[model samples]
Target: MPLFVSMTAGGPPDQVTRRAAHPVARKGINDSPSKVIPTNNFYGNLMLGNQNQGVWTHPYSLRWVKGTGNSSSWGFGVSHIERSQFAYGPGNPNKYFIAPLGITSIILSAQELSNSTALTTDSLEAFSVNANLAVSAQSGPLVTFPLVQGMGFFTGVYLGATALIQTDVFFRTLSGPWTLGTSLKYKVLLEDGRTWLFYVHSSQGYVNPQFILRSNTTIQGPSGFRGSIQVAKLPEGQSNAESWYDWAAGVYPVTGATFGTFNNGSASYTLSWQKGGDTGKTLIMWALPHHIQSFNGGVGAAATDVQLYTTTKGQATLVASDQWVMVEKLVTDMGFTPWTPQNRSVTTLPEKAIVAINSVASSELNQDFAPQTNLDSMYFSGKGLAKFAAILIAVNDLARNPGLAAAGLSKLKTAFNNFVQNTQKSPLVYDQIFKGVISTAGYSDPGADFGNTYYNDHHFHYGYFVYTAAVIAHLDPSWLNQGTNLQWVQTLVQDFASPVADERFPFSRAFDWFHGHSWAKGLFESADGKDQESTSEDAFASYALKLWGRVIGDAALEARGDLMLAIQARTFQNYFLMDSSNKIQPASFIENKVTGILFENKVDHATYFSADIECIQGIHMIPIMPPSTLIRSKAFVTEEWNKYFSNGRVDSIPGGWRGILYANLAIINPKASYDFFAQPNFDPSWLDGGASRTWYLAYAAALGGCT
Candidate 1:
C-alpha cells in the first residue's frame, strides 16, 4: 500500500516495473539541504534543540522551541463553515467545507519586536515558510480551487475543465446574496485607463451571465466620482441565496482599462462606454474615472435604440462630473440627479476621504493572492508559510511552462515601460507600481487627503518589485535590449535598494516597531535592538544577492543567501508550537498567522487576538523562499528532491496536510521531471492572475530564456 515508483523514464512509472521503498524511508528529513527553520527566536539557542525537554512525538509533530505548548493541528481548520439558522449539529448535520491544509506560516518584521504582543505594526517586509514544513508531510491539492459563487436555478455552468477564478473573491456573500450566477477573470482587460466606455461596453457579455462584479478601479475621488461594479446580487436585495456566483473574476478595471499619455501630454485614444446595461455611461481619463452619467432617454443625452436591462440596485444611483453638480446620488447617499453632463458635475472627493477609499481598495488587493492575487503584497509579511508555497508554485510553473515564464517577464517589462513612459513627460511625483498595486490614500469619503501621496514608504517595495522584474529581465537580456522598461528597471533597483531606500543602511528596508517578545531570543545587533528581521526577505535579499551574483557570480553572496532559507527553517522548527502531529499551531485566527512573527520565544508568548485568525489557516511559506532558490542551489538531485517529486502517490496524506501539497513537492525537487508536469489534470500553462505570473516562471524554468 505504501510502495513508491522511480518516475525516471517519463510517464507514470509502471508500478510492476518501478516499485521501490519510498524516498522518505530511505532518506531522513535532513537528507535535504535547505529547510524553513523554527526557533524560540528564529536565530536563537532553541534552534540548537538544547534546554532538554520531552520530545513530543506525533509521528510528524516537532516541538515548538524548547516547550511552549502543544500543537495537534497545523491550522487544519475550516475556512468557510456552512451554518444554518442556528441548528444543533448533533443531528442537524451542520458541516464545514474546510479549505485543505498543506501550508504553514511564520511572520517577520522589518522593525524589531518590542511589544509583548504579536499583531500591531506599521508596515510589512515580506513572507517565508518554516524549513521543517518544507521537509514535513507535504500535503493538500496542488490544483488551485475556484473562488466559486453558488448559483441557484442553475447548477454547473463553470464546473467543466475550463479555468476560472474561484479563490480570492471580489467580495464575500456574508449577507445579501445574488440573483444569478457569475464569474470573474482578471486578464481580460488592459491597464490603459482610457477605455472606461469600451470596457463597460465589453462587459455586456457578462450582464447575462448571472451577476458578475468588477471594482471601479478608476479611483478618482471616492466622492461623486461615481463608477459601477456589479456583484452577483440577489433579487430585490434579498438576503436569501437565490442567485449566487457560478464563477467570478475579480477584475480591477483600473489598471486593465487605462493606458496613459505620451511625451506630448496626450493619452491613448479616449473611450466612451455605455455603462451598466445602457442605463448609464462612463468617461475615463489618464486611466482613472473622469466621469459617469446616466441618460434618462426621454429627457437628456439623446436616445438609443439599444434596449437596456437595468439593475434594480444599479452600478451607480448617481453619476458625477467636474462641475460638482449632483446630477444623481446613490439612492443610499440621498441625492438628486439630471440625465445630462451639464446637470451632473461634482467636486473631487475631499482629501481625507480619497485616502481612506484607496487604503481599503489596496488592502483588498494585497490579500487577493490565492491563484490570482499579487504574490508580493504589503499585506503579507515576507515570513509566512503560504507565501513561500506560492513561490514554490511559481517555480513549478516555470519548470513546466515556457510561455508563462516569458509572459511574466514580458508583463513586468511592460509595467515598468509604462511607468518610464509616464515619468518621462509628467511630474517626478508619479506612482511607480505594479499593474494593480495601490499605495495612494483613500478617497471614498468627504475630507480625504489626496496630496501626501504614499510615495515614500510605498516606494520601498520597489526594491523587491524591481528584483522580481530583474529576474525576468535576466531571462531575456533582449527584454531590455530596446525598451526603456529595461532602463527604468535598472534605475528603480538603484533608486530603492541601495543607499537611496534606507539612506542610513542603503541595503535594508527595515521598518521600525516597539513593544515586543514572544519567548523569542536574539543576539541584539544593536543595543537598542535594531537588526535585520524576517525570513521572507528572500524576495528582497535573494534578489539583491542574485542580481549582484549574476553580475559578478560571487560565492559569498550565495552563502549569504542561505541565511534566508536557514532562518525560515528555524522559525518553523523552533518558533511556533509544532505539536505531536506535524501541523503548525496557529497563533491567531484573524491575523492569518502573520502576527506570530513578532515573538522571540514559543511560550509565555505575547498576547494573542481572537479575531485575527480567518476561518481558514495555512503555513505562510509561499512567498519567502520563492522557488528561485531551487535553481540557485543545486540540491534538486538529492533526497530533498522527493519534496517536489512523486511516484504518483505524491498525494499520500498519511498524516494531515493540505494546499498544493503533493504537486508542489513533485515540481520543486529535481528528481520530479516533465512527466510530472505533463499530467493533463495539472497543466501549468493555464493559471490565473492580473496577468499570469507563470510567464515569469517560464523563464526561470529554461522554457525560452538563456538558462
Candidate 2:
C-alpha cells in the first residue's frame, strides 16, 4: 500500500522521521530482480476500477522532436537534445513521487493583504531584482511548510504561521530560448501574531545549474520587526548540517568585490560565494530578526524536484521550450526506455500470461457449467460451444510438456466425447438446428428469426464450435479422419462454413454477398431486411472457416474464406466505420465515431444491449485474421484510445472491452500494452468472464516482442 501523506495537517506526527526512501513491495508480477523496475505503472489498471493507479499517476510525459525551421538551433550543445517544461500532475492517481524544486522561501500571512504585489521567477542568474519585471498577484493553490523547531524560519521567525506564499506560471507549449521564473508577494502572520509584508523570489534558467531564492519583509514601523535572513539547504543524506542558517545582523549594501555579511549583533555570520566548494553553491547577507529558511527535501537541488513545499500558498509558473519533440528528449534524459518483458521468447510468452491462463482454466475446469434451463436450445448450444472451445484450446496449448500434456489431453478427450454426444446426429442430436426447440426460456426465441433466431445470433453460436473443431483437427488429424463417431464435428463445421448451395445449409447461408458481410438474422424477417448485428462475430465466423480450411487442406474453402475477408474489410469500413453523416447509417448512429448494428436499411449505432461502443469495435478486431495494416490504416485504434482512454477514463471500463482495447493497443503501442498487462494487480475481472485471459495476454505479449 502507498503511504498517504495528509497535506491538511501541519506535518507528519513528531515521531515520524523523514526517511530517504520508502520500503518496496514484493517483486512485481512477472518481474525479475535483474530487470530495472519501472517506477511508473503506465496506467495499465485504468480499466479495472474507477480509482486511478498504475501508470495513471504519472503527471508528465515526454516525446522526441527533431528541430526544424528557425528552431533548428535548439538542443545544440546540451546533449544536442531539448525537452519540454515538465507538466503538472493529472490528479487522480492520489500518489506523488516527490521531486523537489530548488530553494523554497515563504512569508507567513497573519492577515489578508491582497493588494500587495507577488512576483515569482525561475532562473539561474545572480540575485539582482529589476523593478520593471513585476506581474499581478493571483490567489490559487496554497504552498505551505511545517513549523519544526530549531529550523531557522521556525525558531527565528517564531511567528506561528502555518502558511506561506508561493506563485508559479505554466506554459503548455514551449519553444527554444526560454526563461524559468516565479516570484510572489503575500502577507504572513508571525508566531507573535504580527502581520508582515514579505517578498519571495525563485528563479532558474534552462542552461543554469543553480537557482536562487530570496525572502525579506518590507513592513517597517517603530513596532515593526527588523529584517532577518536565513538560508536552508535540503541536505541530500541523513546529514542536516546545512539544514538552516540565520543572518545575525540587519540588511545593508555590499561595498567590496568580495562576499560579506552585515550584522546588528556583536557576532558576525559571514556570507561568501565562489566556484570551488559547497559555500560557492550559495551565499547570504542580512540583518538580525529577518529569518531565512531553506532545507533540501533530500531529493534534489532543483526547484521542480521538491515535494515538501505543497503547503506553501502561491502561484507557480513553469517556463520552458514547449516543443513537442522536447518530451522525447526529456524521456531520454530521465533514462526512460520502452519496457519489454525480459521473459519474452519465440516459443513462449511472459510468465504472467502463462499463469493467468492456467489459473483461469483450473477454476473453470473445477466448476460445473451453469444450467441452461431458462434458455432455449439455441442459446445453450451456442454459448456452451464457445466456452467449451476456449477450454479445449487452453488444454492443447498447455499440452507441450509431457506431464501437463497427459492431463490436458485427457480433459480434451473427455470434452470431445461430451461434445459429440450433444452435437452429433447419431445417439444424441437434440441441440442440432433441426431438433432445437423453441421453448419459453429467458430472451431466447429460436423461431423468431428465419428458422432459428436465438435472438438473431445463430452464426455467432455456430462459429465457436467450428473454430474449436479446427483446433482439435490440427492437434490430431486421425481423431478427425477415422476416430469413432467424430465425423460429426466436420458435419457441424459444414453447417456453418460450407460453400453456398442447397441440399445442406445454404452456401455460406449466413453471409450476404450483396452486403459484403455476414448477417446473423438466421430466420428473422424484418422491415430493415436481413441484418447481422454483430459484425465482430461475423468476421470471426469467416476467420474460423479460413483456419478450418487450412487444417483440412481444402484450398477452395480457404480461398472462399479469403474472399469473405476481403469483402468484409472493404464493406465494413465503407458502411460500419464512419465519422460524417452518411445515408448508409442513420444520423443517430454516429456517436463516438463508430458504426453499430447495421441493417439493409436501418442502423442503430449500438449493439443488441447497447454496451460500450469500444466493445463492439474490439469484437470487429478480434478475428485477428485481417492484415494488421487493415486495422491500422483506418486509424480506428488511435481514435478509439484518444476518445475514451487517453486521459485515464478507461478506469470506468470493465470486462472484455478492456482486453480488446489493450490487446489492440499492443499492435501499435506495445510498450503501453505491456505496461498494463504487466501490472501486479492486473485483474481478470477486466476480462469479459467468457474471454481467455491467458490467450489475450499471450497474444499481446507476442505482438510486443515477448518470447
Query: Candidates' lDDT values, in order?
Result: 0.23, 0.35
Q: What is the TM-score of each candidate against the true structure?
A: 0.29, 0.44
lDDT of 2: 0.35
Taking all chains together, the TM-score of candidate 1 against the true structure is 0.29
Q: Any idea what lDDT model 1 has?
A: 0.23
lDDT of 2 by residue, 1-707 (tens): 11111111111121222222212222111223222211111111111121111110001111111121121211000000001211222222211111222111222222222323232211111111001001123432121111111111211121221222221111122112122122223233332222222322222211222212222322211112212222222312323222222111111111111111112211111112221112212222211111111111221122221111111101111111100010000000100011222322224445655665566556555544433111234434444445444454544453123344345445555545554544321122212222122112322323422234232454565566566566656666665655342345445444444442223232334564323466665332243333555566676676666666666766445445544554455556556654443233223333344555554323444566546656656655553322332423336566666765777766667776776677667656766765676576888666654454544444455555244
| Count of residue pairs whose backbone atoms collide, per candidate | 160, 101
Question: Lowest lDDT 10-mer window, candidate 2?
Answer: 323-332
lDDT of 1 by residue, 1-707 (tens): 10011111111111111222211121212322222111112112112223111111001111222112121211110011111111221211111111112111111111111222111111111111112211122331111111111101100111111111111112222122232223221111212211011011122343322223223211111111112222222222332222111211122111111111112211121112212222322211111011122222222222111111111001111112111110111111101100111222122222332333233223222332332222223222111222222232243232332444344444444434434443211112212221112222321211112111221222223434444444544566555556455444443333232211221111222211001111212111111111122323323443443343343333333222222223233333322312222223222221122223332111111222222111011122222133323221222212323322235443433221212232223234312322233333543332222212222222122221111
For model 1, state the Cα shift of residue 636 in Å: 17
Q: Which stretches of candidate 1 lie over 4 Å from their true place?
A: 1-412, 420-438, 441-464, 478-507, 511-545, 548-619, 623-659, 667-677, 682-707
